[model samples]
Target chain A: MDATERPVADLPAQRDGQEVIHLDRVEKVFEVRRRAGLLRREKREVRAVDGLSFSVGRGEVVGFVGPNGAGKSTTIKMLTGILTPSAGTLRVAGVEPARDRARLARRIGVVFGQRTTLWWDLPLLDSYQLIHRMYRVPDARYRENLDRCVELLGLGDLLDVPVRQLSLGQRMRGDIAAALLHDPEVLYLDEPTIGLDVVSKANVRHFLADLNAERGTTVLLTTHDLTDIEQLCRRVMVIDHGRLMYDGEVAGLHRIAEVERTLVVDLATEMAPIALESARTVKVEGPRQWLAFPAGQPAAPIVAEIAAGWPLVDLSLREPDIEDVISLMYAGRSAG
Target chain B: MAHGPGRAALYAAVAAKGFRRYATYRAATLAGIFTNTVFGVILAQTYLALWAERPGLGGYDQAQALTFVWIGQSLHMAVAAMGGGSEEELMERIRSGDIAVDLYRPVDLQLWWLAQDAGRACFQLFARGALPLAFGALVFDLALPASPGTWIAFLTAVALGLLVSFGIRYLVALSAFWLLDGAGVGQLAWLVGMFFSGMMLPLNVFPGLLGEVARVLPWSSILQLPADVLLGVHTGTGLLGVYAFQLAWAAALLAAGRALQSLATRRVVVQGG
Candidate 1:
């Protein structure tokens, strides 16, 4: 009955504990069309993921941070069997995602932000019920999971309401619950916090943190939100332009890139771009503008001066969180 | 695929529950009804005009042609009735790579989708298709059949037509796996089916060699064959053969559907994040 000693291949499609995901030299290349003119055409291949590989340990919460086209989703897709890899080996819950996709389905859970896995026209409760059956949760187990999800997500009132009627925050909560209903060993959350109000976003972060600690679920979270990486994952995977930039601790990301941080001033009046004592505004717009600073800076003084500026309507300090660091890494990638 | 109640029933339950949940989209269903009725009028008008000059084109009388147009409206709403033939949702899933979760679920993907689609289509048929058909009948001096046998034959033909349409749409959806623009693929499929599937006109009415080719393809079955049956043109053993062919074609398309699904899944290439 123990899961540890099972043959890597005999790895039951459903994994509950330890080493939920493993990947070796995984790559994903996409073929895109480039038309120059009415007559001219070109076929270009984008290396969305290039020979990038890493494994998610049991109960490990890994952050998949990337820019817009960074290969975060690609990595998750390859891991989950939604897309076949151009090259390399990928495994989750002891099954090869590509070949054993169906078997893997029962063992892993997934949530996509901005998209409800729940039926749009149906009640949230009904969507949960559907997921319960879709994953073949035992009746008793389904109840247990459902109860937990409702309690955790505070979905009591919204459960009976149709998905279309619910707010985005409510829908997201419902989506999270639906993914967890199956009790999969690994949960792939793609931008699960996108567009959520800060409070709702916090709730999801907290819930995810708790979910991993309590259930020992290997959670691979992909997001542009740096706070997600900071709050959830100690291990981080950075992908850019369809290639793995770095795979290591979250701290290593800032070190890998000359992290670019920006400070914006909501100026009361217009002014030309000014060079900062410590850094420069890489690029600037009119009065309401941005000033780029080296990753590590004494932000307190800068904010204080800005707050004291006569024309400054509002002033806020920003740092390169996960998105900035990952983008820099991506922009620095070696071309194929 | 799994025999156990836990998984198979779970999928069915989810699909059923999801379908029930979708029933709440009264607004959507209502909108569909309005659109379908408008389209039905257009179809009915065309049918009425086509048979006006000819005494019988493929056995269609004045009344029967109207029936065919009405039935086509119903089938268009029915084939993927609820949500079965949505290439857009599929494309979004693919783009976001959310389809990974879908691929993992322990159920027949096609069946699960087909069931949900049925929910939408069924709602449209009642809310939009049937209502439009009735309105068309009332407004236009369309013929009503004299015998119950005509009704039975018509029903059989309409059902067959539904199967054929569903198969064709599903085939079109498979194009999303590879196509950069899923909508383009879907549009192409719609355009081809519209021209050849007899959505616009009976295959017999086509001016030249195109008409001959149209008959060979199942597109004609979407509207033409059902209309033919409704008009009471196919008599005696011919009826049996036509019904048999319809069923046979459905079975063949079902096989093709399975094949396309497998092929598309295999072709999935998770692109850049």
Candidate 2:
């Protein structure tokens, strides 16, 4: 059949509570040789991803978060069929990724933030044109998608520029647009905000949120930037030492980690650190004092205790940052 | 988008992109032209000096010998450049983990790269092949093919030569999948290719047994056969035999490349960051 003869359906209807991505105890072990002593070598098995099992429902925007070398990238690679799991079952959109990689490629979009998928020497438009042919995107659909991406990503003025010349932020936006030109049902973004400025990060986050909400594109995002998760992912999974440490809502992570929320109290006059039973003062600056209490604890009682004991001119409670929560979780895991 | 361009169109696009990529390196192309031209001059002079003493050596007169020199020079970039160091590019991509992205695409990795090399060879055939031959013809008394048939046969032999060369390079690059570093293998292949393929000197000049062995090897199909056909060294049935040898090697090596590529993909270990 001719390429143009294909139907123009947008997306397959999501089955009720059906998982788009499913992994059952998948494991990936890499055999690496390391220098032992003079001219000797040691063969070691590095279990990059060990016994991981998770399911992402249709249209769910999930964040896969971890510290460096925590198997996050490994998982993404497996999902894209770039790496095959050593053991266990893995499926994406009802297809085994490694076995049906070529077919899976048509249904998924991927972006790796550290390196570009664009042709460095070609203009952005040319890269898109090549991708159009590579993915076999229909002519009319290609134009429509390009127009939408160009306008929405603010890529109109930059389309003629070579990808090598674009700033990190602009190039990243261009990469995102390139991935989506084929209208994939699932988008896998690995560190999509790694090296962007604040404004660019916000822009990427906003675009991703809109993409997930409006298009119902299932997004699996791997990022070091916690703000990316806070803004985009309602469901976040934390992995460390090749194990899932936590998987739930973003707010629920603070409770799992036993993280502390900070309360900064400003006194009318400079005084010694206020003594409060409800909360411990972690830092004291002339007229201002910082207190730490369990994030799960009510801040009202602590505020009342401080007000009763000292001259509480102004006070505010700051929720725990995701970074702090994750580190605390890691620390607790190691200690235990 | 529901459907994309067909496989043939996608391969063509990759080839065109490769052509544009190499075309942008104007300085390198000029330098390559200069280097090939200089080598052609030196080779022509060497052949002239040798012919002055012997008058006719290895059944080639001075003019025919000079023509061989120029043809060898013109085809050098088309064959050697296309054959050389693509292994390094593949190894670099593997080390940088960019191979992951490449594997994720729907295209077959071997065919995609083959198309890219085809584009590069097409450009070099013009920029590096024709210009040097024109320069040699202008400066020296170069012999031309006697008939249209010889020209057509020579062109067909050259095309086969390119396919054989690409096959060899593809195998060398595929080594990176297992060896992790293809430099050593690539260097070794280059040495064997240069000597046996008659890029440096005609295989006919090699001592009796060595020349016979070179004729049977696939590398000879890459340069020597084409050069012989271009200079009208082989005629009639002998010429057909030469074409058959080239086609056989091209087919064999390309099959080997594809088989190796399949094995390599199964055990792809994308290294580093």
Docking class of 1: acceptable
lDDT of 2 by residue, A1-336 (tens): 121222223112322356789898999999989999999999999999999998887777888988788888889988988888999999999889988899999899999988788988788898999899888899999999999899889999999998889999999999999999999989999989877876787789888877877787889998876667766776789988788888777677656665577899999989988777778889989899899887546677888878787888997766555566667876877888
How far residue B133's Cα lies from its native spot in candidate 2, in Å, is 1.5
* Steric clashes per prediction: 17, 4
| lDDT by residue (tens digit), candidate 1, A4-91 | 2333342223333456677778887778779979989899988878878666667677778777766777677778777888888888
- What does the i-RMS of model 2 come to? 3.0
The DockQ figures for the candidates are 0.47, 0.37
Native contacts, share recovered per candidate:
0.78, 0.63
Which has the greatest TM-score? 2
lDDT accuracy of residue A24 in candidate 2? 89
**Cα RMSD (angstroms) for every candidate in the order listed:** 6.8, 7.2
The sequence of per-residue lDDT tens digits that candidate 1 reaches over residues B14-66 is 44553465466678777877787888888777776777878677656677667
Candidate 2, residue A105: lDDT: 95
